[model samples]
Target: MSELNVELSETERSFGLRQIPAGHARMLVIGRCLPQPIGEVWNALTDPARIGAYFAEPQGDFRRGGDYELPGFSRGTILRCDPPRLLTVSWMPAHGNGGELEIHLADENGATRVELLYASVRKRFAVMDPEVNEWAAGPGWEFFLDNLSAHLDGREVRPTDRDWQSMEGTDRELYEARNTEWVRVREEFEREHSPLPSPE
Candidate 1:
């Protein structure tokens, strides 16, 4: 297995490291810590307006047992909610490839540790080549979580900003390097965990 050589930032937790076996599908968990209390962190997540500041602009009902439409993208159902602690939802994409999105909040010392789990993702690309799917989910979540950290640091939220494109040139360079490392790590992880050959 290849070793990762890049120095990752504190906020660079991406999807390449979190693939786990989940029955019929793979489960991906991504997490980051915001230097804020759990209550405030929870507010930012559950409050639709504040959520839009970092991630997608959530519209329509987004509460427990309500139907949620992710900004202008997918239609989902809010399966469960425990204020400031956990949330579970199902995302049904436009073309019908979707999965369960679960968010967990916990107190880490004083900061809020935010863990997001997306399970049973139905992406054909994952079957074709598992590591390839990281390209689709990793960087975007990294950007959004970084935005959350920025927001908690009292920086104004740039509601519609993207790293690879909208970020300043130097910033994108760093992100590109980080993304490259993520892909490499994922490839190695898959190789290291692949099933062994059966005896002849």
Candidate 2:
């Protein structure tokens, strides 16, 4: 399979603060269009076999209220599952910074549009440390979308961990350039939407 270019120009990213039961959390919204039908895109996201092909090997029950784990990535419960439309899950990583993740799918023209929303509580003193900001989540999701695109295009999809380690020459440079663009986008988001006060 041939490699696909990392294209952020086709993606729409937004950031905001949302009030959840726990408190105020940072929310990252990423929207992108896939060159496939909505049903195909939805299946790739929900089917264990298909997901494993592009994303991670998901284990455990897949229904609402069921628990699931993405091996080394994250483990969470399925909060909601609406076929070919919306999927919401609780996201709990090993770092213990838990959050909620929502995947919304829609038909755009003849293709499918995917919107991924992740909201995690802001860590205390997060402002003191620039590295802890929510913007850090941007690149990971972008990488996933890129992988998804490749899978839909019938190309081999490299696992995130292996992809980074194996990337070289132009591929590695492209990935780094994408990361830099994400940083700029995050800065612009912060300037336009001031963060909400940290919940007491």
Candidate 3:
């Protein structure tokens, strides 16, 4: 899959959705870069008012040790906060499955590179819906990231970009194909890395 476009090509942009195998569960990491300044991009992510303009309005103190509630989505606790640089949060979706999210930001030339790692995805998600690893979480964040780009550019958020379930055309096809590949790779990684039963 190519880096998503919103009219102009993001020359310095990078995009990825991958699972890193671990002892217990795979880590779901979705990363991308926006063709925007680091400060602006940081504000777009951290400011509640700015976030509400793009993503859901999270209710929380938004400080270290504070917890945020994004109704109908994920409830997150602020584990660490560093201005315009890094933010780590513990994410627990309404379904009760939990994970750790590490948000890292940097200035690359003039664009902002954002990397998010959502760690220790529960086994049940893959077991229940192997078709979409990260399940709704992957595509959902992708949508929000697109909205963040829109918010920075001072344009209306693309309607189709609002929800992952409403994907269409080439994006839908590519997304499904990518998911299939992820499932295959993750299964292979698990099979190879899984420790064998001892003294059975």
Worst 10 residues of 2 by lDDT: 125-134
> RMSD in angstroms, candidate 2?
4.4
**Clashes by residue pair, model 1:** none
TM-score per prediction, in order, is 0.72, 0.82, 0.72
What shift in Å separates residue 54 of candidate 3 from its native position after superposition?
A: 1.5
lDDT per model, in order? 0.61, 0.74, 0.63
Candidate 2 to truth, TM: 0.82
Q: Model 3 over residues 1-200: C-alpha lDDT tens digits?
A: 35444322321222223332222334555567778989988888888888777767789887999989976568878988998899988878756656677778999999988886665445534222534324454444455576788889998875532344456787565455555544664566567767422111
Residues 36-78 of candidate 2 have per-residue lDDT tens digits of: 9999999889989888888778999989999999987789999
The best candidate in terms of TM-score: 2
- For model 1, state the Cα shift of residue 180 in Å: 1.8
| Backbone clashes in model 2, listed as residue pairs | none
Please state the error at residue 72 of candidate 1 in Å. 2.9
Q: Report lDDT (Cα) of residue 20, candidate 3.
A: 25
